[model samples]
Target: MSRVLAFPAGRRAKWLVLVAWLIILGAAAPFAGKLFGAVENDRLGYLPKSAESTAVLEQQEAFPQGRVNPAIIVYQRDGGLTAADRARAADDQRWMAGKYMPKTPPPPPTVSKDGKALIYQIALVAPPDKQEGNYVLDAVDAMRKHIGDPGGGLEVKVSGPAGRDSDQFLIFRDMQYQLVLIPVIVVAILLLVIYRSAVLFLVPLFTVAVANQLGSAFVYGLIKNTDLVINSMSTGVLSILIYGAGTDYALLLISRYREELARHEDRHEAMAEALRRSSGAVLASGGTVALGLLCLFAADLNATRALAPIGVLAVGSAMLAMLTLLPALLVVFGRWLFWPRAPHVGDSKRAHGFWTRMGETVQARPRRVWALTSLGLAVGVLGLLAFNVPQQTQFTTTPDSERGQTLISAHFPAGNGNPATIVANAAQADQVKTAATGSGVVGAVAEVGRAAGKVQYAATLNAEPVTAAERSAVHRLREDVHAVNGAEAKVGGPAAIQLDQRDTNVRDSWITIPLVLVVIFIVLLLLLRAVTLSVLLIATVALSFGAALGVSTLVFEYGFGWSGQDSQLPQLAFVFLVALGVDYNIFLMSRVREESRRHGTREGVIKGLVTTGGVITSAGVVLAATFAVLVALPVVSFAEQGFVIGLGVLIDTFIVRSLLVPALVHDIGDRVWWPSGLARGTRQRAERGRELAPDKSR
Candidate 1:
């Protein structure tokens, strides 16, 4: 296993491995550039075919209007609108009608009861060849430009589905560059600081960059050719995962390589030994994360399910590069890459450091150390009481669409712009409409279109879109419409979509969370070859996850003043924190197990802590910082994800892995590795006892 792991760094194979990676990168570059183009951001792309909303969307394409994207223009004034303000709005509507809807004039503007605001609805017809999201974005941009700067304190802004989509598109477009550039900068700076070598940081950075390119190309192929669902959010996460996890793997291997370099004369031999020592932990870490992400395949939401393939590919690319390309590159560069602090054969190992002092402190009162850390983490769990699902306008800066919606809500019905859509059999259309209206949740029901034996109706809700009240109303609306016999009725539109998204996310959390835990536990068992140790590590990581989430909840609600979180945030956060949190433990414990064979479990724990503390902490900080880049995004969901995950990583790194795990193991003694020979006081114990005996000279 060790020889195979080290094969890429072999004397002859190093150059060959480099050549192979270059060839693959060249082939992948073209496809990588096209990944963003293949992303599916339309509502249909995120909804499964089984969803009633999806059914409505599919049926809508058969109508004459054919899945039109509505852009609502809100014209408002604080004072009651004058005749000239009304005339300007009318002229703008006429201009929009002549330009986009030449044959079908839009309905006349509806005036507010206060006479302070009017809303004009225009349905932008989607072309057969163009993507729905892109088409809406283009049309909305043109419309916004045409209605630029309505004067006299009369505000004009586009809202509804089209306007919101346009704003989201702008954020996603910026995300492509921001996610890549910012993380790369963060990782590069951290690597330089950690290594303190001018040349050493570039090898891992270059390797991970190549891995990212390769991962993107593969993802593009899946999205372009297969039924895989890829979105802007998933792609953004993919970039972060590649850089963060890939760099982590690089750090572990490089640290081990430096140690080997101090012991062996040949760089190739040193690298081979490093791979032999560290590759198992690296493989286990990567496998745990990949399988944890794979658990998302059980998720009902298309967006969540899409993360399964994206995460697997991202981790795979990173692991492959770190295990193969990075090792090969390091061997080729030789010890010179370390520059001023280069390690040489026969150099004394610097095992005692600040971490050794920490271990000694824990050694004095292990129980007290673990107890205090555990209590602090448990306290943070209380913050879960504040968690709630945020509103649809989860953006850092208020977009034009949100401002327009606010105006519309203040004047007209809250759901006037975005209504719940119902599709039913043409024969029972009237019955379905009557049932929906009588359901007591709908404010108004209007026939939208009829085609292919089906009729569609847009039912305006009494509550605001995407709110709990709106979700409840959609449910009642569905129950009423379904009661109409043989109508085959389904309630849909934006509000229903949100309701389904929330329910699916709930279902997904139940399924994926357990699956991730079970999968990780199994990996830990195999990696550690000790059931007791595996269970303990899993428990510690879970505790870390809860504490991080609890603290994040408080910060989100109180510090950021965010109304709530995204429905998918909890599941995503749990899977990532648990999977990645265990990684630092894997690095530390794997070394502990190795040291235990010679020094016994008690001393081995201390040695492992002192040896691995710096690299693991550095790796954790790198991972956390990379995820922190998501906070730079204007979208609240991304920012929340970034902040929570980043904080969780720091908690796991500084407290859980650094102090708690080591202290608990110290207090537990050899029993922590129960059933292992070291725990049984075998022949190795006699040698360990002799080594640890007090030195009379000292």
Candidate 2:
């Protein structure tokens, strides 16, 4: 075992590894705190660079207003606006435009039909080098103070790109503060209960904290030097990944170390043997997730794909820490880390407790246990029939932005703040206007402005800009206007962007899911070294994924009552559920393969289940709790993602890896390891049931 060692060779070698880890942690501490500064909040920027939505954004840079943010002023008076109220609305618009946009005064307010509602659009140009979003927030705050709330039978709200962006920015910013503080508390409490020993509980926590810092520093460095982009969601998810997965690796390694302590007289050899024993499973688990996460790089949505680099880094670093830093720390601290319940020679079997009994029960009737579990999972899978993935953001309440959206939709063309614009040759301006008006979806069409020998016609839709109907109307308007003779009309706006994003997300999901499976299959083949076992593991995990998605869909629709999922949820859910779900299988099967070679097939399956079950379940619980932290975030999409992935992990841990896999392998006997040496002599496979005996003897 020492011949293939990477650190953890002896007592002195352990100290050296620990010292190196501390130095690395201390050096990375500064950069780790800077991770939040690298976050981006631009919803449009979430699209891939080459996407049509991204293209629309780029072309907007050529326009007179460029990409300036707009703060929409929506005012409504009951019983229709009086003469005084109409004049007040006009004065307020001119006042804000002059105060904020002195250089380029904004257009006049557009009053709604029935003269009850008015919209005043104000644009704010951000400072050239700023990406923090605080500039726009500062502007929004200034306006709110300047135009204090009115008390008459009139209502007013600040809404639109600037207002919504400002609110979202603050929400994510506040979330970043809570993201760091909350998950740590959750993990700490859970770890305390699971380990019982105060020092042992802190070991994984300390190790993962250091691991996250190192991973975060690397990410921050990447963003500083390259064109890499991250957002609040990035850091938020990274925190969960680092803590959840890192702690998982720690728990596995430590559990094995405790087991090895009873077999080896020297703590150093016990530590070394534990590292050698558990390192493969940890590496396999991490690699499964790392490879699956890497598939995100293939996604067309930048928000989804951006998780790849950080995820790979986080998980890869976790594997490294488990193999090196954690092992070294355990040896350095010695057996006292386990304290009052420290492992002594021959204590492994007696300490087995509940898992030993559960293993015997499972081994007794493998078919019944597995069949029942599979049936339960199938019930969860049936919920897939009710699943409807939404292609838009779902806000839980009538926030200022949504309230403004409602007013616009009710009293005027719903697309008042963000109207579809058709850019055509100036010669075809009349035909473009006529085609846009005749499209039926457009309530009003006018030549708003012209630039570089092109006419820009703005058409206000009769539907809310982000709704499916608005996107449909915009699509038809573009087709109709472009069909007019000699009119090369290019349509772009909020509706068009949403439609393009939805299309790109659907396309990306189809491409990435197959790629993810291929990646995971290759990883499993390498780890298991048997095609049959690898393929079966993949199939079981895929089924687990389907079942998890089915269950999550029902919860999101009925429990939370959310209408639609984010455009990228399907691909994200599949990648996370399949990838993370396979982690527990890797932990189980890797141990099973190791034990199968030593003991015969039946004994190996029983021993494998007993040994790995408890630690993996604890890991799963910690991870599920870690991800459920996202439900506390401001955005519903984060909550949705957290719910699905967390649910998937529990399914994998409790049902799939715990029962279905172990029992199936037992029922199949040596054929489970087909093409391997164990497959050659099936009759010699079953050994005496070691746990069922009264005494521990070799």
Candidate 3:
């Protein structure tokens, strides 16, 4: 059985593995560059197809004017806008009319009641063949360059819904550099500190660098050849996942290799033995995470579903590299890879380290140690009582569009740029108007765009588009519009879409959460082969998730000066935390089972914690640090998601895996493997095991 894993240990086999990987890397290179081209960032795409908002958005594709993204130009002066400011704003509209989107000229400009700001709204129409974001970005750049700066103490701000969105689009285009650079630098620093060996630190980095290229290229290929509609943001996330997860797998394998090398004289034999022992845990860890991520396919949200494939591709690719390329490199390089502190055939045995001391304490008073530790982590879980995920996710803090939105919202109707858009059959246009007016809509409903037999109406809201009042108004509009005898009317817009997304995501949580739990339970049960123990493992991970969420909310609220989370944050964070948090449980327990096969269950529990504690903690810290690098991203949602996952990994690492799990195993003793021989007082003969086992390896 070890022959498959030990294939890389052979002299010629290692060389062949390296050469094949090189070939794969070369072939996969071009597809990596084409990744971002296939992404569409439409907000409505995240909703279920049956949703009215989603239908309206999907139907828009058949219309010619669907290519347009609106832009708002706000000309503001401190006290009030003078004649020159108003004239300049007017000229700017005319300046853009023929030069920008000539055929579909933007309508006239409107001034605020206070007279300090002039609002000019324009529709930026993309060409028939062009991407909407790409075209909007070019037009925005031209609008910026064309303005230069409004003179005479007047400030011209390009803002509103489209402007804010376009600003983030530009950020996405430029974020690739920082995304790659930050993780590489951060991972390098952490690996150096953890390994404390120059060559060992660089090996996994080198291995992951190659793996990331190959993995990203393969995912890009999937986007290109398949019907998979991957979000552009997923690629950046995939990159970070590959490096972080790849290095983690490498660390575990190499640490075992070092231990085995100290026990055997032949480097090749030691590597083969290490591969046989470590591969099960490595494969199980990767599989648990991969399948847990796959459970996201049950989500109704497109973005959440998209993450499932991206995560699976990344994990599968990273796992293959660590199992194949990493082992080959280690085996071929021998102990030389360790450089300054290389493991030898003989090393000191029976030592006392932090984990050893911990194991000893757990053995003495298992119940007390775990109870106190559980109490401490449970206190952090109390913070979840106040955790609330908000609907609105901010893209930029200080974009001109954001400031312009505030000014326009304060003076005029807050939903100036964004309005409730209604789709109605032409015959019921009058009924549509009447229904909207009766539903407490403040503005008139007029047709803005045309389809074959249907028209679109733009109904301005009395409240801000993101406000609860506007959503309620939109909901009421939907009811009234549908009340029309034959209106065939559907209500949608910025507010409606958000309302629909919130509803859809809530539904998704209900579906995906239970499915994920079932999926994880099945995987763990198969690996551990014990029903009682698998259930216990799942329970602890679920508990950790609750505590992590509570702690994350407090940190985001107090530490980051943010009061709310993205609506999708809790669900997404749960998937990551449960899957990732359980990852440490899998790592620790896999070793304990191995030890139990040699010694009694109680003795094995201590041995497992003492042996695997350091590597698991190091792996956790590495993973946490890798995720924390996401703080470098300017997007608020990404930063929040990063912090939550990173912090959860640490909790799982230092608190859960290092303390909670070991103590539980110790206290439970043999029952952790119930219905099996080990749990029923069927103990391994330790005396014979000591005689056969090497002193250093034990």
Candidate 4:
């Protein structure tokens, strides 16, 4: 038997053996002590202390016990609240208090000016931390039920942290419809287009289903040992990986198999050769992407860090499925995968003249094209400095847009949408009290504590009006609190944490931005075998990144009024910019080098562009569209992420790789690869091949 079917010996065949071992090991993993130990660990809810701990203290001191839960009541009255409406709202509040809350009157209920909106500032009998069995959900549900149907012009509804959180959960549940539907619909369409055979389509998707199961099982096991918060976005991201990477790998394998069939070879030889030709590219591409995701480990935030292993594992599972399950299925199905299309062996030659003509035109005048592309990119990049990152926390939204948003907007100061508490360990009680009364403070409350021979004051701040200015207040509060006589104080709150996040982000960007660039540069140099070419590629990618950020800044800051500096924005941008941008560069430059080696610098540049342009452009379109789907999400942060990354991919394809780099290669001539001995050797070898080939054949 040939090595391909042998399941060892051959590098690609060995993949089958290796993956089989992994599957067996993973299957047996549930019995292992490590897996059980991870599950048994109990450190789940411990979020890392934000670097902005001191700042949070200041904000907390200004707020009412750092608790700002406002219950909203919506009712319409003909003129004033009918005796009926007031009675109904009051009865509903009473019923909620009896059922979930303690039977106590809360702070006076504040009604809206238009007589449509009313807010009741209710206090929980148990502190928020001690609420039982999702008390918030229980209370809200109880409130909704008691609101009594409106007879004429009266209706009542409830909202607050507890209320909104419950609402968020409900929205997430409803989103399950889309989550399930979109992937199924998209995969079905793509599969139909790619395979035209239903059985072939089903095979890859079935493999993905298995990969997803194994991926989730492994992830659940990993999280047992780590303190991680899996956000709602995780499911979407995992789905993308399973569907995207799985289909991409299948395409590669199937395409090669079909090519092998043209030679009329037996299935075994065809499968082995298919694996031999395509596996390197598949592994290279997958490895690069996995490497990019793993870079998230460098982030300090738990959310980003948590994503690191999940992303790595998800892609790794797909890779395993591709290598093992996919190959075995192909062996089982053989030539039938093509069905009506039938497997046909033929040289996979790209049409020559298309890229050659484009290369020739670009080479003819590199300066005009370069200049135009640079100007367009510069204009986009200018939007970066003007952008503002909002601290707004209205991250989730419902399908009923106008109503839910209007109710939320009417009831709370935008900053009150998400308020975090701060506790400062004070050395002296009096000093802590005095500091809590600072001018920026709207209100204050405290819990006295004695631990380690020092008093700890859990000071609460009325952070209702959180703003960029409020963050400064938080900073000033920290300074004032720390300056208290004869006391050491430490601060913590959401706003304070946000401020700390800003500072940490600034520092991390300075460190990681260069590091990312270096990694990308090294990859480019290794791949292209040219220092000048690599440097230019990096420069182009940086420009594309700047442009992408600029576009994101305008959309987020000016268009949508969202905070531009999302917790994950900078790092996510860094990863996408370097990874996706370099992908474009690689696609272009690989063809560029091959064409140049065969055709000389001028003809090669043209040929490379003409040949690779369509493929890279298509790939960019697919990748960009994939990310663009995030805009449909209600969260501003997600919209910004999708738009920015999508724009980056588009810009990298059209402006950087398609236009600017080609011109530069044309303009630079031999110096593009100067200092690279291998490029020179490759060019010489190409010349010898030309000389040796018969004139008629050439």
Q: In terms of lDDT, which candidate is stronger, 1 or 2?
A: 1
Candidate 3 lDDT over 1-698, as tens digits, reads: 77988888877899999999889888877776666666666555456777888777666665666734567787888789888777877888898876766767677778888887778777766665866667777788788788887677888777765677677777777777677667888889988988888877777888888888887787877776765556657777788888778888988898888888888988888888889888888898888999999999888888788889889888888889998998888877778778788888778643648989989888999898889878887898899887766534365256666777777776677777676778888788888888888788656666787778787877877776555676677777888999988878987766778778777788888988898899999998888888878888888787777788888888877777664677777778788888888888888888888788777777888888888887888888888887887776767778887888888889889877877878888888888887666676636455566678764446
lDDT tens string, model 2, 1-698?
44356466476788888888889988999999988877666645666676554654555556675655667888888688777777877888777888777877667777887888888888776655866276776777787767677767877778876777777676777778788778789889988888888888887887888888888898898778866567777888888898899889888888878887898778888877777777777877888899899998888777777889989998987777777887777787888889778898777454567778878878899999988988888888998898655444546555667777677667776677666756777888898888888889988886656667776666778776566677778778878986988866777766676777778889999999999999999987777777787887888888888888888888878888776676667788889888888888888877776677557677788888888888999999999889888877657777888888888889888888878888888888887777876676533432343434532212
Clashing pairs in 2: 390-565
Ranking by TM-score: 1, 3, 2, 4
Instruction: Give TM per candidate.
Output: 0.95, 0.92, 0.95, 0.78
lDDT, candidate 3, residue 587?
84
The lDDT values for all models are 0.88, 0.78, 0.79, 0.61
Model 2 TM: 0.92
lDDT of predicted model 1: 0.88
Q: Give all candidate RMSDs, comma-separated.
A: 2.9, 3.3, 2.2, 6.0
How do the residues 283-344 of candidate 1 rate in per-residue lDDT, one tens digit apiece? 88888899999999999888889899999999999999999999999998888899989999
Task: State which candidate, 2 or 3, has the greater lDDT.
Answer: 3
**For candidate 3, what is the lDDT?**
0.79
Model 1 spans with C-alpha error above 4 angstroms: 390-393, 682-698
